[model samples]
Target: MELVSGLFLSKRIVYKNGTPVPLSVITKSFEELFNIKLGDCYKKHESVISRKPTKLTEFLDELRKFIIEERENKGYR
Candidate 1:
């Protein structure tokens, strides 16, 4: 997923999580993987918001295609 304006740019399916995951741990993992200090992802940003539904739907479709391809390669689908 892309990081736009210091926020994860994705279409969140679950609006709220009953078992909340630790965001700090996630960000730390991302920072380590990307080799970049995502300090902004840690802070609050009022300006950052989700993309439009049309664009988000496109992204979701692309992601679904990728997942299908991977599963097919593994002979699972």
Candidate 2:
């Protein structure tokens, strides 16, 4: 993934707690890892908001959806 505006430029995926979750999971598993808060959100602009301690699986799922939608937006078959 690419960085839109903050320190969360990239993330990796791996397993944890006998669960195959993305490395992003660490954002919550170890909040201290990034000096971020769980479920804490930031308002970038009046109409824009960003998230910290983001969940990995959620990120990937959304990323996939975005990519697909982008493709469709660009008239992909």
Q: Give the best candidate by lDDT.
A: 1
How do the residues 1-77 of candidate 1 rate in per-residue lDDT, one tens digit apiece? 33432333333322365343344555666779989776755352222335565654454578789999999999994
Lowest lDDT sum, 10 consecutive residues, model 2, at 40-49
Cα displacement (angstroms), candidate 2, residue 53, comes to 18
Candidate 2 lDDT tens digits, 1-77: 22221223232333455444433444455456656554432222111223343543455568789999999999998
Candidate lDDT values, in order: 0.52, 0.44
Per-model TM values vs. the true structure: 0.41, 0.29
Clashing pairs in 2: none
Q: Which stretches of candidate 2 lie over 4 Å from their true place?
A: 1-56
Error of 2 at 11 (Å): 14
